[model samples]
Target: MTLRWSTLDTDAVPAWAELTNLLAKVDRTEEYYDAEDLAEELSEPGFDPELDSVAVWDGDTLVAYSQLRVSLALTYEGTARAMIGGGVHPDWRGQGIATRMFDEMEPRGRELATERHPGEPFELRASGGLEDDPARPLLSERGYEIVRYFTAMQRPLPGDPLPEVTDPRVGPVTPELAEPLRLAHNDAFASHWGSAPQEPEQWANGMEARSLRIATSRAAVADGEVLSYVITGQWVDRELYISIVGTRPSARGQGLARQVLTASLAAAAATGEYDLVELDVDSVSPTGAGRLYESVGFTPVRTTATFAKADGAS
Candidate 1:
């Protein structure tokens, strides 16, 4: 079979979404995106489709694709992170399509990282589905090590007893609180592994995503300062995804995170538009976030692993 290779553009959205949803079902990743969602991603801040993405097709059928992105901000360790993402169609899996895609992505990731953060150390990172994901062996063979695991947890909406948000400080997120919440998010995730502050543009992209449900999102504030927040969005039908949940360091032990999260959950439940609320948390969260979610009735449904390879200058 003769294969055609080209960089991605707006026209690739339909094929990309088709292959992605297929992979989701075959891999049990539960990640599904529509053409609009894929288009939005292709337009993310700092991502140049022509330079950062690639697609492979056999005649008229798209068989595989890959994307590379380097963070705009450096992690707390002062290291840049380049993330690789994409998949090969299930029917085309064993034909070395994935390896070929990675061969092009890895060096480009390094180049992008060096250009973005000159002279700094960087890590090439990729995440895969469950324990036995096909990509795991390829990642391992390439010297990537399993560095972290994240658990996807969920609770049925309107049925699970949610904690009451009695604090006067907690309320639904508002347009006026956007900037404050962004600042709070950066501060809250400062020490989390592989996390970096989201510059204004990146933060805005997320806040403006079509799926973001401001009415169901909640935040806590005091004296005009945002202390904690829970941002919710929907990708899958009848499911509310908790996109971000954080509390600034100064407010850690006050249970503010729980307050805002529960507030968001309660708001979503009240909507009666969702059947479940879902979120993924670091398995070994520094703030004991896993326990907090569990206390709120979220049960683990699956886990994904992150693999990393150190690269670039020391």
Candidate 2:
């Protein structure tokens, strides 16, 4: 088979889909990215398809892919960062493909950083599952270090009876509540590592994007203030995912998060539309969110570690 490498194009959808299916099969999970998700990634305001991504073909079949995605808004001023996420087909692993992908990505990532924030160092980031993840060694050998660990947790929604939300103001999030919820999110996560305060446009283009419905969202408001919120994402069959959940700092210890999450889950169950709810939490979160999630019946299913390398590292 002839091995050829080139930048990704929209026409390669079939090959990309095949690659993801193969990856999911190898990992023994039903998880797979649909075309909608791909379209959403490509639509990201900061993404530059030609300059930030690559794909490798084996005799006319795409077997490996990579992309360097730079965040337009810096988490910390004077510091620019880009996240690298891609996969090699199971049959194509251990063939230097990952290394080659990194070799191609590092320079492009650095160039974009230099252009965006001159004189600022570029940090290349990637993540891999804690066990049986092929990206781990390639990243480590390239000088990337584990900077954080995150746990993907899930809870089955068996339509169990839910606790009543006593807060009179607790209810579905509406148009008027959007801005306040956004503000609450910013305030809630202010102390998180690597968090950047988002501009309105950025926030809107995110979870509140038109294509994603927020019907399952719930919030707690008191005295015209949003105390906590649970914003949901587009539903995939029977699974409902929470894109963001937070309680304002001033509302901490008021059981607001629990109230909102429980309300959201119960509402989802009431519709008989979902069987599971999922979210990821920082393993060492300062807010002890993992415990909160556990109290709500969410259990850690897997751990993924974020890895970062200095610019120009080999």
Candidate 3:
């Protein structure tokens, strides 16, 4: 197939889905994209579809693609991070297509970073699983180095032990409580590595995403304030994923996180709608999130490494 390269166009949505399905099959994971998901990414705050994304086509079919997302981080360095992620079709791997894709991504990322924060420090980051994966070698060859690790964990929900909780009122996540949940989420993750509190606009949009099942998610409330929350969402028909979980710094040690998580898991189990619960946690989080998850029966099933290319690197 003759290959053609172009910036994102309206016609590439289905082709992108096909590429994602191929990648999911190769990685033994569920299909990660649909048209709605693609649309959401395009609509994200400050994203420009044409300049921030690229694609490779085989005649009428998209064979590979990537997106560059720029987000400002409020760390001590006040860094701007440009994340580039995408994949080549399974049958099209090992043919230098990914290199071509990154050729488009890296320069675009730098341009985006400068646009977002002129004369400020920035980093180019990408994430992937497996040491032998093609992206690992490609990123490393491009001066990217691993900076952090994140673990995807899973726990069987059917017949699994659920923890007991007595304090802190826990209940479903309703529309009225969305703002409080957003505030709590921001406060909870403010100290996390490479994280920045979500802008109010971004937080509002996230709460409206189709993937988040607010009715099934749980939140801990105390004195009319949301203390902690476990944002549950349906990944597939058989799996309930913890989209995000956090406890307010002031609310830690009261088991608010555990209590809300248990409520969400027990609800999933009681409905007999899911076979497993899954979540991702930073491996070296100061909050000990990984250990807290392990205590609730979540076992690490996969590890993803975060790689970065520093400015002025080859």
Residue 97 in model 2: lDDT = 86
- Candidate 2, 67-136: lDDT as tens digits: 7887675654345888888889888888888888888888888888878778776788897656668778
Instruction: Write down the TM-score for model 3.
Output: 0.93
Query: How would you order the candidates by lDDT, starting with the best?
Result: 1, 3, 2
Q: Which has the higher lDDT value, candidate number 1 or candidate number 2?
A: 1
Native-referenced Cα lDDT, model 3 = 0.81
lDDT of each residue in 127-229, candidate 3, tens digit only: 7656656788888888989999888899997655787766649988889888888788888888888886777788888888877877669998877789989
TM-score of 2: 0.90
Please list the Cα RMSD from the true structure of every candidate, rounded to 1 decimal place. 1.4, 2.3, 1.8
| lDDT per residue as tens, model 1, 133-211 | 9999999888888999999999998876876778899998998888998899999999898899989989989889988
TM-score of each: 0.98, 0.90, 0.93
Clashing pairs in 1: none
Please tell me which model should have the higher TM-score, number 1 or number 2.
1
Clashes of each: 0, 0, 0
Q: For each candidate in the order shown, give its overall lDDT on alpha carbons.
A: 0.89, 0.79, 0.81
Candidate 1 C-alpha error for residue 228, in Å? 0.5
